[model samples]
Target chain A: MLAASGKLDRRELCRALLADRGDLLVVAGLGAPAWDITAVGDRAENFPLWGGMGGAAMIGLGLALAQPARRVLVITGDGEMLMGLGALATIAVQRPANLSIVVQDNEHYGETGMQETHTRHGVDLAGMAKAAGFPRTMLVTRPEEVPALRAAIHAGEGPLFAVAKVDPSTLPLVLPPREGAYLQARLREAVLGPAAHHQL
Target chain B: MDRQVMESRPAAADWPDGLYELLKTHRIRQVAVVPDAGHARLIRRCLADNGMRVVSLTTEEEGIALLQGAWLGGDKGVLLMQSSGVGNCVNMLSLAITHRTPMPMIVTMRGDFGEFNPAQVPMGSATQAVLEAMGALVRRADRPEDVVPTADATIRLAFNTFRPTATLIGQRVIGAKTFGKD
Candidate 1:
């Protein structure tokens, strides 16, 4: 659907951001973003929403609020972010310093026949987030700027928002565990230690 | 944890106050909510307490995912909203069903049993059934005195069993909204 493709490969960008991720809790939006996170390798700290469409950012907000000491990151596609744009305002009001949101703007809904999303029509998500009171917002289109975005996620005062323009190439699907209950328990055990592992 | 402001009084225990105390006793720290007139008293009471963090939402679905995240971080939470907000939460409730997230929702009724507006009827009547269809256990507290006890039970049911539960405070308890003439 896009005539001029973005230079950055989404898989490489996700791999770069997750490298050396220490105590960072990740929430990946459903669809391509979830696949991207899973491709990098699944960790207990990583929560990929297998179905829920508009919840990644708010989930990051809640986790950040509950654990201020740890960093929280949400990686979502443009279509997913647009679906839950109101969450940015709610998250801004709370201003959880540990939270960061990154939107992979491919301008097309990759899972759904590459339908053109709002981002394709110059809908600026970074601008909206900046207006919503996020202290730091970035629009990264060049390859060199990826490091800054990663640094902001790993070690920066946030709730930061970033939208990375990525190439809309159809890639192989990398799925996480399909069972939500198992994934939920896995995360609790990781974050809360062995004690959180309770019988159903 | 400022329990003194919200508590330190057993004499004048209304249902809202009792419910507030119940949340504190249950160790619920995150109050994921969408504001509603029926729940004003308890919402204000929660905001007043230093121990509770009332995270307001633009819509009700955010609360479900927010609570799911809270559980990941080892903190418990509760969702407070009105009956109509339940419609907004249908798709999002799947996270709780599939993940078995422990979520307790305290909903104040708007359209049931003497509602003024006809617009409130559809979702209000559908609230319990919708939640049940989504695999969330449902209960109702139609009397003022029963609100706290039912809420407490539902909270235990949710956390202990890792199931999503909703406790509906009936419109009769809220004394259905009236226009200027009435």
Candidate 2:
């Protein structure tokens, strides 16, 4: 399926972004981004979506807004990001200092038969994000740039947006949990403590 | 109903203020809106209140996903949109329903009684059906007095039971819009 894979390995990129994660909240888009994050480690702070296709960025926005002090990062594929392109404008307007979005741009939909997405046709997601008013926007194609990307996610003053051109080759699926209720409960309890369910 | 009576009188509307009180009581920290005139009063009240974070969404579906994140981060929230915006939320609602996310949506009706626009008829009339099909429990609040109580029940079903619930306020309660100058 990939016409040609990008230079960066997605798993390696995720590992770098999540390494030594300290109270960092992550929202992964459905498909590759979700698997990539899970591939790193299936921790509770990682809210890997199994189905919500176009909502990864907005989820990060809500989490960032709700917990203003905590860092929020969203990892999503290009197709996922394209479908919700308006979210970039939305996130830009909100300009949450704690939120950062990393789009693993493979230029193809890695799942669903590896179809070529808009990015393959020369569409620039990073440019669009920059135009949408993201304070910091980066397009990463080299291995060396990942450290800066990781550092930005951990300590950058955002709302920041980054697009990393990752390898389009399909990888093993590392799903966190299929049941939505279970994942939701785990994340809530992990972030809010054991009494999360009893709060209402 | 007489033509002059329908044209002349501004309806007594307390539901917006009443709804605001209930949201505060629920401690809804995040309030998302895809602005609509029907929700103007409630949005105004929410904006004035210092306790909540009112987010202006580009689309109704954003609110759906936003509420999920809010709940995941230990905060309660709601979405306010118009009947037409319900169509935009169908796909996103799947994640909300499966997650059993407590989403209390307050949707003001558009295409039903006294509707002026042809564009709104399709989605507005089908709003209830669409939500129910998506696994969101739908309730209507037609009368002025019934709006608050219905909203309360919808909120309860959402948070206490972790079901996606919608309180669809009718055009009558929201007041009808017309093309001609009043």
- lDDT of model 2 at residue B158? 92
Global Cα lDDT for candidate 2: 0.88
DockQ of each: 0.62, 0.67
Q: Best-fitting candidate, measured by lDDT?
A: 1
* C-alpha local distance difference test of each model: 0.89, 0.88
Evaluate candidate 1 by giving its C-alpha RMSD to the native, one decimal. Answer: 4.7
| Candidate 2 residue lDDT tens string, B1-182 | 99866653343356788899999988989999999998898999999998988889888888888888888888899999999999999999988778889998999999988888889899998999999999999999898778888999999999988889999999988777887833
In the range A1-200, model 1's lDDT, one tens digit per residue, is 12246468898889889989998989999998889999999878889988778888988888898889999999999998998888999999998999999999999999989999999999999999999999999998887888888999987599999999999998798889888888888888878788886633
Runs off by more than 4 Å, candidate 2: A1-6, B1-12
- Backbone collisions counted per model: 0, 0
Reference-based TM-score, model 1 = 0.94
